[model samples]
Target: MEWLVPVLIVVALVVLIGIYLWATYNSLVQLNVRVDEAWSGITVQLTRRADLIPNLIETVKGYAAHEKAVFENVTRARAETLSAAGPGAAGIAEGHLQQALRSLFAVAEAYPQLQASHNFLQLQHAFVDTEDKVQAARRLYNGGVRDFNTKIKVFPNNMFARGLGFTEREFFEVADSGAVSAPPRVQF
Candidate 1:
């Protein structure tokens, strides 16, 4: 019965390996989903901010129609934010949007009437809220990326992660610190 024992041992090893692979694959799928959800959260916040921008621009435009360049810059940045495909691109777009918003706000600063408008004030508050949400969403996305990347890079998982279709996720970070050094001063 020595042959029977060796066969049983081989079967046991195969079963154990199969179990390991299954668990690892499932974990990776879960992490991938989490990261995607986190990214969606970021996108939602960004979209909210994008939607708020036009109203803000219109409000400012009523008071500062002469500031055509500022309005155009904000509009272009909003388009970039809307069209950005991935986290890296979105981060860069965010930098541009922030700078544009700052310039828009700077122009608004010259018009006390615009700053004091009820509509403008409400939009400003909404923009602030969206910015806060965007920051939170970015944190969640990057955290998920960090966890997923760690899982795929750890000893045994690393050997088969790529084969299983898991890959590293890009973190959302400002590509140019200088471009976004100062937060958009939305406050009057």
Candidate 2:
């Protein structure tokens, strides 16, 4: 009877450990999936912005041919952003692209024709909307990363998290404070 009690206690402990591990693994998986979804949202916004850039450039090109430097900067920044690999790299590239786009828009302000053009106006609106969506996605992704990182860094979860090969995720950060420092100036 003494041996039976000890045996049952061992079985109960095993079951409890199994439950804990299962729950922890599932929680981590959900958090990772959320991060991925958030990244996808950002990617969608980026793709939309990329698609709008050429039209914007062309519209401005008609009236602002003398502004070759602005056009070239926007083109180069777009290319770099498209080629960026991960979240960190992409964020930096995106910041550069946004700054370049801002400069391009600033140049456009000097050309009344470019600013008045329907195509330019539409493209600008689209880009602004996409940027908003991208910012929102970044926030969501960072939030998910924060939660997941916290999970793996806490006491009991930390033990299992390390054992299960769960590692921390990097936050999606913008390198250019200028891109997000203030609201973009838009004029109708």
Candidate 3:
């Protein structure tokens, strides 16, 4: 009777440990999927922004033919961003694109005609809205990565995490502070 009680206690402990590990593994998987989904949201917004750039450039070109250098820079930046593969590479390319967009907007400000045009205004508004969404999605992705990475580093879970091929995710960082920071003043 004494041996039976000890054997049953051991069995119960083993089962509990098994269930705990299973739950941890599933939670990690869910977090990883969330990160991927959030990344997709960012990609969607980026594509929308990219699609709008051509139209914006065309409209600006019609009104500001003399601004060829600015237009070319925007085009080149957009192409580089679209071609970038991973998060790190994309972040660098995005910073360049953002700088170019800022220059383009600055040029537009000089031309009252372009600013007043309904199509140009609408496209600019849409691009701004898309940029906001992309930023939000990036935050969510980073949060998910943080959670997943933390889980995989904890004690018992870390053992199973390594065995399951789970690895930490790279953060999508902005390469340039100027790209994300407030616009610089151009006082006369």
Candidate 4:
């Protein structure tokens, strides 16, 4: 019957659309998970660096007692990094923290005994290791953001993504070029 054929065609079309929608939703979910995981990686590195800051500050403080302003700056920056609400906020806070740390080490450089101390050298090595990890984690997070943003902005998927809760994610980046402009003046 002509009527029966038309009904079957309509049903087939509906089934196809349902399948497509399901696949798109799943893709979005997977991409969102990757973005979250990548962010966690960055946070882990941030936390590690935060944990190292106080010890570094104390080590330098013992030798550079007159540098109260530098110590205060580092302390405030550390708190900012810890309290930052998101990657965008954290990146800015981290840049300030790195600068404070540089000033701290720069002042420490004036003290020959402190620079040659076993404790100070060990701390510097640990800080350098954490900084490297942070760089790798940042790259991973940015890559995830790029993938997720592209998925939510492209055609077909974009058409349905907005209907869902899939929005573009912000990429994490350095707040200042100066943050990485100098290769960490680790000169003991």
* lDDT (C-alpha, whole model) for all candidates: 0.93, 0.84, 0.83, 0.88
TM-score of each: 0.96, 0.94, 0.90, 0.93
Model 1 agreement with the true structure over 1-188: per-residue lDDT tens digits = 77999999999999999999999999999999999999999999999999999999999999999999999999999999999999999989988998898899999999999889999999999988998899899999999999999999998999999998899999999887776788889888
lDDT of 4 by residue, 69-181 (tens): 99999899999988887888987887888788788878988999998999999999999999899999999989989988898888888888988988888888668868867
Between candidates 1 and 2, which one is better according to TM-score? 1
Q: On lDDT, who's better, 2 or 4?
A: 4
For candidate 3, lDDT tens digit of each residue in 1-188? 77999999999999999999889889999998988887787788778889889998998899899999999999999999888776788789888988898888888878887788888878877777777788888898888889989999989787779889899887788799678685321211
TM-score ranking of the models: 1, 2, 4, 3
Over 48-141, each residue of candidate 2 has an lDDT whose tens digit, in order, gives 8787889888888888798899899999988888888778899799788878887887888888877878888888788778878888888998
Q: Which regions in candidate 4 have their CA more than 4 angstroms from the true location?
A: none
Superposition TM-score, candidate 4 onto the true structure: 0.93
Q: In candidate 1, what residue range of length 10 has the lowest lDDT sum?
A: 174-183
In terms of TM-score, how similar is model 3 to the real structure?
0.90
Inter-residue clash pairs, candidate 3 = none
lDDT of 3 at 7: 98
Q: How many clashes (backbone N, Cα, C below 3 Å) per candidate?
A: 0, 0, 0, 0
Alpha carbon deviation, residue 8, candidate 2 (Å): 1.1
The best candidate in terms of lDDT: 1
Q: Is candidate 2 or candidate 3 better by TM-score?
A: 2
Off by over 4 Å in 2: none
